[model samples]
Structure formats: C-alpha cells, structure tokens
Target: RAPEEPLHLVLPSDRRLLRIAHAVLEHPDDVRTLEEWADWAGLSPRTVTRLFRYETGSSFAQWRQQARLARALERLASGEAVASVADALGYASVSAFVAMFRRSFGLSPGRYFDTQAVIA
Candidate 1:
C-alpha cells in the first residue's frame, strides 16, 4: 500500500482556518453543522470555532452566512428568482431568507440583484 500513505497533517492554526473557510465557500448552500465541519477537520467543534473566529474574526455561523450570501448574489445576478435561491440555500421561505439578507446587506435580495444588473 506504499507504506500506507502518510497522513496529511497541518499544524498552523491559520492554515486550518483557511481550509475551513474554503469549505464554507464551496458548500455555501449546504447548511453544514459545526459537528460536520469538526469531523472534516479532525478537530472538536469548539476548537474549530475558536480558531476560525480568531483567524477570521467571525464565528463559523457568521462566516457561513457571508459565504451563503456571496453565492446567493451570484445566483440572483444570473437571473434566478429569489424563491429558488432561498430554497436552494436551505431557507424555509423566501420571506425568511429576504429578512436575513436585508439584515446583512441593508437591501432585499431582489434589490441587490437589481443593483448588480445595473452595474453590469
């Protein structure tokens, strides 16, 4: 088995945070739990949260929200309806998603996408 292939290891906390951040970006709409990310990182959820927050200055949930909105922006900019984007991002209702989005971006998703369209 070629010496069983040495286990990949990363020790620097920043490197670990970057890996977790990338995972959030790639799986933005998945609503991954902290336990899921902890398992993937081979660390406890508390450790992941601490290091991620220290390195990124945000909790995993907060960072994940940013990631989801980034993806949502792209989808909306591509002309997908807010309803479909909300559903795809694991939101139970368009209104709920819009409320969260407005909290983050100061405008509703429809208006955000309209701005993008105008800018383009």
Candidate 2:
C-alpha cells in the first residue's frame, strides 16, 4: 500500500458501513469485535460482515488491519520511533509490530523506510 494513501479515500456508500469505516479509520488502535462495532453502528453483526465484504472486497478484520498498517506507515514516515509507533498502533510489542510489518511489506520498518528513501 502507498504511504500517502488517505484513510477515507474510498468509503462505503451505505451509511451504516460508512459509520463503521470512519470509526475504524479514526481509531485504528481500537480492538473492538465486529459484533460490538455492529451494535455501535446500530447494525446486525451478520449484516455488517456481509456488507463489509461486499463493499470493501475484504473482511472487516482485513480492512482494519490494512487501516492499522496505513497508519503505521504514515507514523513511521513522519519519523516516529518504532516502539512508539507499535504502542500507538496497539501492538503487544515492538517485535510483534515488526513481524507484521515484515509480513506486509517483506521488510522491517527501518529497512522499508530506507528503501523508500532510495526509491525517492
């Protein structure tokens, strides 16, 4: 994913899904379950699940993970410390954040930014 990508770039047209998407984007660190989110949005859990897949072409969990990653990339690019970024993103530890970063981008955060610098 591009580091410059905006969080609200493509929102679901459905108001209920839009509400949840906005909430997730605004609070990527929020670890709420789908049922809880659905209740908050005044939606049925099953409806939210199906609508997320239909509208976003991904599951709610996947969408939230991507949002978190986007936020991570933005924060890291702004020169935030790795540990600080991990904590802000609600990772259990810096290592866990690094692991997820590796899985997503095939490089550690430091290396990833170093590479972007070179590419730029």
Candidate 3:
C-alpha cells in the first residue's frame, strides 16, 4: 500500500485512474487499453504516465503488472486454472503468465497453489 501522502498524487484528473481500475475490477471480461484510458482521463499518454507514476509511486507498466498479478491471484484462488487466468489477465500465453508468476512468487503457479514448490 502507498503512504498517506505520496510525493505527488496525480490520480485526481477526473479520477480516471481510479475509474480505470474500477472498470478492470468490475468487468475483467473487458480489458481497457492505455489509449482508451488516456482518452477517458482527457490526458495525453505522456501525461498519463507521469500522473500514474506520481500517484502510484511506480511506472504505469509496473502498476499494471502488479494489478494483473493481483487479479491473477484472485482468479487462481477462486479455482480458475492458470490458462484461464492468463487469458483473462491479458497475457500473451500461459507460459508468459507462468514466468511472471514464478518471478513474483519464486514458485510456479501450480506448485505455489499446491504448496509443494520451494521458494528459492
């Protein structure tokens, strides 16, 4: 979680970042593009990146990665398989998802889920 007061909080532009987050959380079936969000937020991509970094204390891509991981974890915990979660999370393929999962947790998804994989 971020601090109470960050160096800068740029999400106040129409609350568009929050809206985009809500949209993703509300309907995972529809993944919104960065361009779409830029339009919705009424800011250029460069400004969006800057504001997103300011508010989240991370680059937009990094934030999106964590968000996608979080969503993947939720779906996985809900009994959804890895392939499905990969598809839903906008991954190019299951292998990509597995790589990311392993990178984040130091264990593959299946082992992580079953508690059989050791953390390196």
Best by lDDT: 2
Residue pairs with backbone overlap in model 3: none
lDDT for each residue of candidate 1 in 1-120, tens digit (9 for 90 to 100): 222212122223576667777766666666668988788878899998888777666677776776777778778878898999998888888999999888877779877657656867
* Number of the top TM-score candidate: 2
Task: Kindly report which residue stretches of model 2 are placed more than 4 angstroms away from their true locations once superposed.
Answer: 1-9
Please provide, for model 2 over 70-91, each residue's C-alpha lDDT reduced to its tens digit, 9 standing for 90 to 100: 8998899999999999998888
TM-score of each: 0.75, 0.88, 0.73
State how far residue 97 of model 2 sits from its true place (Å): 1.3
Those runs of model 1 whose alpha carbons end farther than 4 Å from true positions after fitting are 1-15, 115-120
What lDDT tens digits, residue by residue, belong to model 3 across residues 3-51? Answer: 1311232333447677765666565545567787778767788877877
**Residue 42 deviation, candidate 3, in Å?**
1.4
lDDT of 1 at 25: 66
Per-model lDDT = 0.73, 0.86, 0.70
